[model samples]
Every structure is written in C-alpha cells, then in structure tokens.
Target: MRNEVIFHSEALEKEGNTLVQMGFRCDACGKTSYPVYELCPFCSSGEGSKTPLSNTGTLFSYSVTRVPVGPFKPPIIAGYIDLPEGTRVFGQIRADVKAVKTGMSLKVETGTIWTEKDGTEVIGYYYTPCGKEKGGAE
Candidate 1:
C-alpha cells in the first residue's frame, strides 16, 4: 500500500502550481476532517460528506527535529496545521527550522513524499509559506 494515496484520491487535484485539498464534513455533528473519513472522530458519527478544503491555514504548533521521520531526513520540521475545515493536521513543514513559528500562514503543496522501488510516485501533502516561493526541501 506504499503506492496508495493516503488522502482521499478524489480530493486531490492540481491547478497550475497549487494543490487543493479536500475534506469530509460530518453529517451528524457538522465537524470537518481532512483527507476524508469513514466517521467523524469528534462525534463518533458514522458519516462523512466530501468537501473542498482551503489551501490556506495557520500554524497551530510546531517543532524542529533532527530525528528522521518517515522518508524525510534529519532536521525535519513537523507541526499541526489548523485548517479552515476545523481540523488540525499533522504534516512535514516545508521551511527552515528557524523560519517556522506559531500562527504562520501556510498553503498546501502537492509533491513527492517518497518514491517506490518500482518507480511509482508516492504523493503526499506538504505545507509552505503562503504567497512566497517554494521554500523548502525539493
């Protein structure tokens, strides 16, 4: 399943250089969760409705780490992003450790999370400084 797109496949698409992410709205509680959901984790309701997610969000929290996580090397920046969908997502931050701060504005980017041995591409969500040039690991 390494080649599988973890986020809802139908929810990802490219428009020019920007990537738009979508989420699911809880039919029961109206809570929103990113990348789709079988149930609302907040209300434990077994219902989800697909909805587009805004590319922009604010950095809720973050940390600088020299420890390796997944396909990324040392000095990785990790954080929780507070999306307009009302859900916070944990992801690899695409910025220098010294440049990250709480409440920083960001936007979603579509890029390689890693590549499989079969030469298949594994795409994943990443965030970067909003309105700025591509600002991190390439």
Candidate 2:
C-alpha cells in the first residue's frame, strides 16, 4: 500500500531511502507554504504551483515533550526550521538531545509519526541535522 500524507494531498516524495516534502510557491505573491496550501496565506493569493522545498534549513526553535502523547514517546523533539525560501515550518526534530539547539542546521524528512487505533499511519515531515552527523532518531 502507498503511504498517506498527513498534510496536503500530494506532498511526500520518496528518493532512494529517504522521503521529501513538496512545497507550493504562490505565483501571485512568491510565498511558499509547506505541506502545500490552496491559497498563499501570506498574500492571500490563489495562484500557485508545486515547488520542491530545500531539505536544508536552520533550526529556529525547539521543545522536548517530557510527557508522552499519542503515538509519540517522551522527549519528542519538535521545532521550527527556517527554510531558505523564507518559510518557517514546524516538524519533529529527529536528533540527539545533546546535539539539538537553536541556530543549528537541519534537513527535512518524511515518515510515519504515529498510527491510529485502526492502524492508519500518520505520515508527515520531520527534521534532522543537515550534516547527518548526529543522525536522526525519528
């Protein structure tokens, strides 16, 4: 069976052993939105096209959830990545607790973040170090 994306209808693309997300660029405003948007939220423009988002970005901010929630375990690393396209997207930061910090570099990824009671997989975007040195935990 094919994977189901949690966000847009068509966003995830698999290459080799990795999964990447496709963003939408507004033709009217030049704004880009992750998981794709029907209309550009920045300028409220409806004209847009599919654009591949850079897998690389800077770690803007992050938080570790000590209390477990849903299909995610405790210490769930979540944060915002400031992409070069001027879009700041949020996703799970898959990295060692010690290596993650503000201003760090990150790369976008795609995977199943959770599974519903009916066994439906929640596939979504995630992040990790751009260098892939510290490695990702998700």
Candidate 3:
C-alpha cells in the first residue's frame, strides 16, 4: 500500500516512494520558508517559488517525550534541524534517545508516522543519524 501524507501537501514532493521536502524562496529577499508560505515573512513579497530543501542537516536541539501520545509510541524523539539552506525544520528523529545529540548530522527520510481513522498509513519526513559529524564538528 502507498503511504499518504496529509499535512503541508504543497511543501512535499513525491518521487515514487521517496518524499522530498520543499521550501518557498522569496524572490525579493532570498529567504526561504518551510511548508511554503504564500507571502515572504521578511520582505512581505508575494513573488516566491517553491524549491527543494537540503536532504541533510545538523541537529540543533532535541527532546524526548516519555508519554505516549495518540498514534505515537512512548519516548518520542523530536528536534530542530538546521538545514544548509538556512532554514530550521522541526521533525521527528528516528533514533535512540540515548544516542541523540546536538550537532549530529542527520539525513531526512520519509516514513509512516501514523495510521489514520480509515487505516491509511500517514507518511511524513523524519531524521536519522548519518555518517560522521557525530561530534557536531561539520
């Protein structure tokens, strides 16, 4: 079965089974926004286009939730990742809580985040620890 992503449909591009996150780059200021805003937040310009974001980023911060919420399992790990394009994105990190660290390099991947009421597998972007940059020195 194919996975379905419900939120921020305009900011997501699907190439077969792979999902790529997109950002809106303001034509006036060269600033980008994740989830694709209609207007530039900095320059207040409406002339911007959607562009693909970097697939890799550095972990800025993270938190572990010990309580289970809805379709999420206990000890859910989520963090803010600083992309190379100067955008900070918040996404769920698919890594061990004990192994998670600030400044670690992470690669974005698409996966099933949860199931819907109609039994659809909700897809979303997630981060996973990647090679090197473990000490945040990248």
Clashing pairs in 1: none
Candidate 2 stretches greater than 4 Å from native: 1-10, 13-18, 115-121, 132-138
| Residue pairs in clash, model 2 | none
TM-score of each: 0.75, 0.77, 0.88
Provide the global lDDT of candidate 2 against the true structure: 0.80
lDDT of 3 by residue, 10-121 (tens): 7678767667999999999998888788898888899999998999999999999999988899889999999998999999999878778899889998877888888788
Residue 112, model 2, lDDT? 79
Instruction: Return the candidate ranking by lDDT, descending.
Output: 3, 2, 1
Which candidate number would show the highest lDDT if scored against the true structure?
3
Candidate 2 per-residue lDDT, tens place, 1-138, comes to 754546434777666766667888999888889768788888888889978788899988899998888778888999989999998888888888888889888977776777877777787778878764455444
Q: Which of 2 and 3 is ahead in lDDT?
A: 3
RMSD of each candidate?
A: 5.0, 3.9, 2.8
Question: What residue runs in model 3 are displaced by over 4 Å at the alpha carbon?
Answer: 1-5, 134-138
How does model 3 score by TM-score? 0.88
How much does candidate 1 score in TM-score?
0.75
Q: Using TM-score as the measure, which candidate wins?
A: 3
Better of 1 and 3 by TM-score: 3
